[model samples]
Target: MKKTSLGIFTVASLAIACQSGNQAGYDASGLDSTALASITEEAYKSYVMKLSSDEFLGRKPFTKGDTLTVNYIQEQFKQLGLSPGNGDSYFQEVPLVEIDTKPVSPTLTFTGANGSLTVKHLDDFVVSSKRLQNDIKINQSELVFVGFGIVAPEFNWNDYANIDVKGKTVVAMVSDPGRYDKSLFKADTMTYYGRWDYKYEEAARQGAAGILLIHETGAASYGWNVVRTGWAGPQLAMVSDDKGASKTEFEGWISQETATKLLNLAGLPKDIQEQAKKTGFKPVPMPVTTTFALKNEFRESKTNNVIAKIEGSKRPDEVIIYTAHWDHLGIGEPVNGDSIYNGAIDNASGVAALFELAKAFKAAKVKPERTIVFIALTSEEEGLLGSEYYTQHPIYPLKKTVANLNIDAFSPLGATKDVSVVGFGQTEIEDYVIKSAAKFNRTVKGERNPTTGGFYRSDHFNFVKNGVPGLFMGSGSDFMEQDSTVINKRKAALGGRYHTVRDEVTEDWSFDGILADIKLFFDIGYTMSMEKSFPNFKPASEFKELGDKRLAK
Candidate 1:
């Protein structure tokens, strides 16, 4: 009788939880395949083909392609009956400073007590800047070669130690020095210090006149052209830093070959970059003077974040957000006779999934207790700008926001028996996913490339940074535990094609995988919306404090 009474009380408690809000739980009867089936491979293929067509002009941040891109998404949101997300408005303006550095000739003249050595561009080095200033010249400033430009206090690692590089040029490693020396930092995986934004911010913090990251193909991931195409445009960032641009300035990345030649002149050992890996590695001031002239132009423009809401029948203010970034490399150099960067798998798949989820929610007649937001963010390709701005300037208080479920680059490669979470173990979000995937006889899995740092590579990082635990998931590589070799090849191949023009629409995709993944994401949103308490990040997650702070409120 005691157990029965407690069980009854718990049931009654759940009933009360439902009464407290209008967010609807999933029908025990479950979802239908009809809508999932409607989200066809052919449809996705067509959308990607159109967007990636040469017409869109490699969807750089502020190109005309952005105009067409945002409008299309806004129209879709309007049709979905989603309410404006950003304060009675769908658009959040992100003001950016675009810096283009076209050095007449980038010359690095490194001098020792003995002699000097000069490095050439492309063959020896490459450089670009983020400071919106025109033509910064460093004629007499000393060049300090810091390993990775990191100052991680948590690790007791300080690349800047006691020597200040203010007004000097920093020739640093592009990625994390920790990556190079695993004994000291998160080896292979990118720490916050590995990010380019971190480098620029650190430089500005030190008052450096310029910062240059030495990029290696292995370290920076993409080639120089990827950096060039994205940087050589009107970039959009928040107007200030507390609100925006406050902490960052004068940033650029140079090739490794360039750094090697300079190191030779500085009398530094070429093979033992490992020396800088240890503690007490002081900043080396090679007698190198670098000079470059940068001239750039910009036309600031407005783009809208596509926002639509399905009001919860009971909890109208609390929300479950479905986010997808809608921009890509617009148009660039032709590859294999094609110049358009149709971001088919890069994100059109993710956006298409966003709509698919919205449609599924609307069709579910069982309305949620919490409002559901469908957001197609802009300028994600330009460095998660739209989502970052949204997190900073939220339409709804994040305290009331249940979760951020992000969709990006849903590869349509045939059906996989499992789903992959980018940050595999960070949250119990995977629990919701596994419970939901069970309906379709699917399984959940961790990303194959945890070493590659896939989790930190998406827009969800913005939400993660803000304390709202976010999830980035995609199709699993294990096709029913299919040959691991095939999985490895396919994963590598798909990763390669992501930012390339080759990623356009194809008849090669099987919608079963896309549908399965979307269903999984939808199930996640539904579960979060129906719960009484917001889902908190796991103990290991860095965002735990954010949730605790909100709960304290």
Candidate 2:
């Protein structure tokens, strides 16, 4: 069961909140609203415009865009008087390789007692592999529907037990089939097993030649266009050790319609779906050869994590990290005439937020007790590559790294009375946020879609996995004393143009929402810096054991 941490500052009650006349209260007493009037809407608008401009080149990884973005971040850190985090250097080099593998024209040679059939790519199947080898192929192999294709002993679900897929391809349901028929599994909430990342990883572990997910828009929460566009672009993989992959050779997704046809060719009843949902279901192979011809060019390049440190007043070695990914999908296939994925909201907002906080601290009358490290990580969208590398090889050890605060895709919804923490119950940092949000009469809420794994999907997961307490929250739509129509106007902008060429800065967006969220983030950082105690995961959190293990030192 999920556990909520004790409300923050409750334990530190007397130590945290200040009296109306106390100097420690963040707000200045007797200060008029006119004092902050100088911090105008124009200032925030101007900042967003520069960060999301087309010259940033969709802020893509391993490109000229990265050159401009990293340089700007480093320069801003310098202006803030933050020293280079990596001994005399701000950059922590992250090597990566871009492998643009074109989906081969699939020759689905289906032979049966009825006749012989051939299927084409897109119309029939799409194949991809991380192998990067030129001769990536899978011919004369069989296709199988493997009941979500998951094997989790904990869930008492193993769709592929007692079966050997040594050299064959497995066609599986995309997401978790349990999503559609909840009674069959977790009931609408997708588990880790349902993710395509997990399904393909299992295929490789099973020694399969290929794996393809059947794409249904509603189930996947993405359209076929997303699959097509993502595959059509240059895909990236991190530079890793020579230890080879137990790679699935021809791996990709097929349309649900095509999957239905393939099942029909195998003389299989479509009702196999319900049977697969039940326990004790096993994978069965259909005699078929899904053929494809994949070709691609590979390029290896290096990227850097821009790191700068604001030294603490006393315990300077211990650090608090504030991070945002400076990389995006980069330049890719265009929708309409626009070719750039400027990444305006996806992260230009995050990068902008980090820099703004750095500036705020620089202007503060007092400094923090622990070092504040501003890290604009590289290749976050590319498998959390940069942050992963940093976690493995830190400028400062994980034990001394106090906490990590990550920002991504700040919605431009007008200010609200609540702030939604992406992974709310994961740590004790929730307490700190709850205490601070109360100042503005804003309540803290949990993620709207835990099934999507947004927390794991972002860079902070790397830190959390390595035992650093982390927090990520955003301004929400619900308002305490605001109009209902006002909330809809903001939510209307949610799905429109996300991750598209359409994601751009405009006058229509009110930065008030972003401004409010950023202010809260600054307060969180300030509170963590001043408090004598270190925040850890609450006992109720799954991650609390990690905090216990570390803090026991």
Best by TM-score: 2
The count of backbone overlaps in candidate 1 is: 27
Candidate 1 lDDT, 28-66, residue by residue in tens: 325444444445556555566665666666555677877
Candidates' RMSD to native: 5.6, 3.5
Question: Mind giving the per-residue lDDT tens digits that candidate 2 earns over 420-475?
Answer: 88766678788778776765567778876655556667888788877788887898
* lDDT over C-alpha atoms for residue 413 of model 2: 65
TM-score of each model, in listed order:
0.86, 0.89
